[model samples]
Target: MSEHKKGQPNKASPEKTHVENTSGTAQRARLLERLQAGPIDTFTAIRELNIVRPGARINELRGLGHKILTHRLTLTDDQGRTHQGMALYYLSTNAPAQVTA
Candidate 1:
């Protein structure tokens, strides 16, 4: 017996939503750590980090004031298939130089 009406979208409980947010936070942390070591491609993020949406994580990092840069290029997958417009994310090394007044 439930009060949920038919044809209505199901909503996640607050606790479940918090868990999903925590998962996203963990994924963002992992992505940041990997980017520190070197550049990370979309395929590598998905295959290794288990992040289905690396771009969203990257955007979150950028929102947090991280200088992440995205480079677009072609990539070859394990199945010998080539993909165009692939994203390669890396931390920007060009910091603003300080000047004496």
Candidate 2:
């Protein structure tokens, strides 16, 4: 006689399951790790987090009373492809001392 239940599969066998980590989830995890480490400059943090430019928009509603600003960032990937997109900045805090073309 089998040990299995009359209507159900045996408990000795288990179903396999697979889970995948998404790019966005992985990015957020990295971002949180960085933030817990210390205070870091926005640009450097953004680069380290592997965050692409186009998605980093500043919330206008939150920036209405502050001196926030935005600028385009150009980056070259390891494959030598150039990407262009906007990076948000806080004018009073993040503005660089020197201007570069």
Candidate 3:
């Protein structure tokens, strides 16, 4: 007579990996600090922050890609009238693309 037995390894038990917090208010603060440092142009700031889409927000401006739109600057006259003209380029480029899953 002979005995037969079977054993298997459990795949369900797994270890969890640690992940660091790379986003939030801290990152924004750092970005703002870099922007104010002096003689640093907008494009350089954008690149340093790795901000792909530079000015996607109202308070921001785009730099280094392609120009999609033009902004008209309005200057007020002594009589309280306004004049419109193209604003000088600080840096211009195409807008960055969004990421998707």
Candidate 4:
């Protein structure tokens, strides 16, 4: 059995020493909401949220036990030129159909 002195404070573990950000929590919640609503491409995230590293935020959501999937998209501009991009968001448990941009 461990004994504690009456006037002493217990030591905190290294795991308990980290502080979390309130803004990050809100951001993740919003990000998850957006993902659930529909596919959010990297461009959308950057444009809508003004996030420089949207993928990092998405990874944070993934670490919190959220099931997030990604699809590579190919888009064609008005000039009929094909361009490659990353679609950082689509939420679905079952396998999704092939996506084409």
User: Please, what is the whole-model Cα lDDT of each candidate in the order they appear?
Assistant: 0.75, 0.41, 0.33, 0.64
**Tell me, what's the RMSD of every candidate?**
9.7, 13.9, 19.5, 10.6
How high a TM-score does candidate 2 get?
A: 0.33
Off by over 4 Å in 3: 1-27, 57-101
Cand. 1 TM to true fold: 0.69
Over 4 Å off, model 1: 1-22, 94-101
Better model by lDDT, 1 or 4?
A: 1
Model 4 whole-model lDDT (C-alpha atoms): 0.64
> In candidate 1, what are the lDDT values of residues 1-101, reduced to their tens digit?
33568996343333234323437767777788778887889999888877889999899889989998877779999899999999888888632233111
lDDT of 4 by residue, 1-101 (tens): 33668887443332332223225555566567677677777767656655557788789878878878888777654577877975647776533556532
Tens digit per residue, CA lDDT, model 3, 1-101? 22335564222111211112123223333333433342223344344544433344213323323222434456554577766762212212321222111
lDDT of 3: 0.33
Residue 20 lDDT in candidate 3: 27
Candidate 4 residues lying further than 4 Å off, grouped into runs, are 1-22, 75-83, 93-101
lDDT of 2 by residue, 39-93 (tens): 3334554555555531332243123343444456675655778777634343445
RMSD in angstroms, candidate 1? Answer: 9.7
Decreasing TM-score order of the candidates = 1, 4, 2, 3
Error (Å) of candidate 2 at residue 66 is 3.9
The TM-score values for the models, in the order shown, are 0.69, 0.33, 0.27, 0.58
